[model samples]
Every structure is written in structure tokens, then in C-alpha cells.
Target: MKRFFTALALIPSAAFAHVGDHSHVAATHLLTEPDHLGVIGVVIVIALGAWLWRRGRS
Candidate 1:
């Protein structure tokens, strides 16, 4: 019974062990998709604008 509980406790961790396996797939999609590129560009522009705004304020 103790061993059974220990195995059950480890079941969730074992299920999560593959979580990092798909990072490259996300990177590949981001690099290859024009929509993602546009989103990234917009984010970069916003970040740069904020930085410039802060710099001017100081």
C-alpha cells in the first residue's frame, strides 16, 4: 500500500516530464510564420516606444 501511494504520487511528475520537449516546435513556428513576426514586431515597437518615452521623461 505504501509503494502504491508512492507510485501514484510520482504519476503526475512523470506526466509532466515531456513538457520541455516541444520548445523547438514553438521556436520554429515563430520563425516561420508571418503573423507571429508581425506580432513580435508590434511588441518590439511598443517596448521601444516605452523606453524612449521613459528616457525623454528623465
Candidate 2:
């Protein structure tokens, strides 16, 4: 959990790039947009649940 939060805090630092005179958007959008960030959060929760399920099965 600590590592996950740390990565989230640092990801924005590398999501940007300058293109000619404009800023290119890709990963940065995920951090900047609420809807996109929400989707990511949902995915993370689903993934964590799956991991726990598999571990319990074993």
C-alpha cells in the first residue's frame, strides 16, 4: 500500500512531454481527469480483490 501510493505520487512527474510548443497528453490525462482517475481506482480495487481471491484459493 505504501509503495502503491508512492508510485501514484510520483507518476505525474514523468507523464509530461513538450511537443513543438504544445504539451502532449497521455498518462498525464489519467492523473488530471477525475473520471479517468476514478476508473483507474476501480481497476486497482478489482485487481487487489482478485489477488486476495487467488491467494485464498491456494
Q: Write the per-residue lDDT of candidate 1 for residues 1-58, one digit (tens) a residue.
A: 4664565565453334333454457677655666556656755775687678779999
Query: How high is each candidate's TM-score?
Result: 0.54, 0.53
Please estimate how well model 2 matches the true structure, expressed as its whole-model Cα lDDT.
0.62
Backbone N/Cα/C clashes per model: 0, 0
What lDDT, from 0 to 1, does candidate 1 have? Answer: 0.59
Q: lDDT per model, in order?
A: 0.59, 0.62
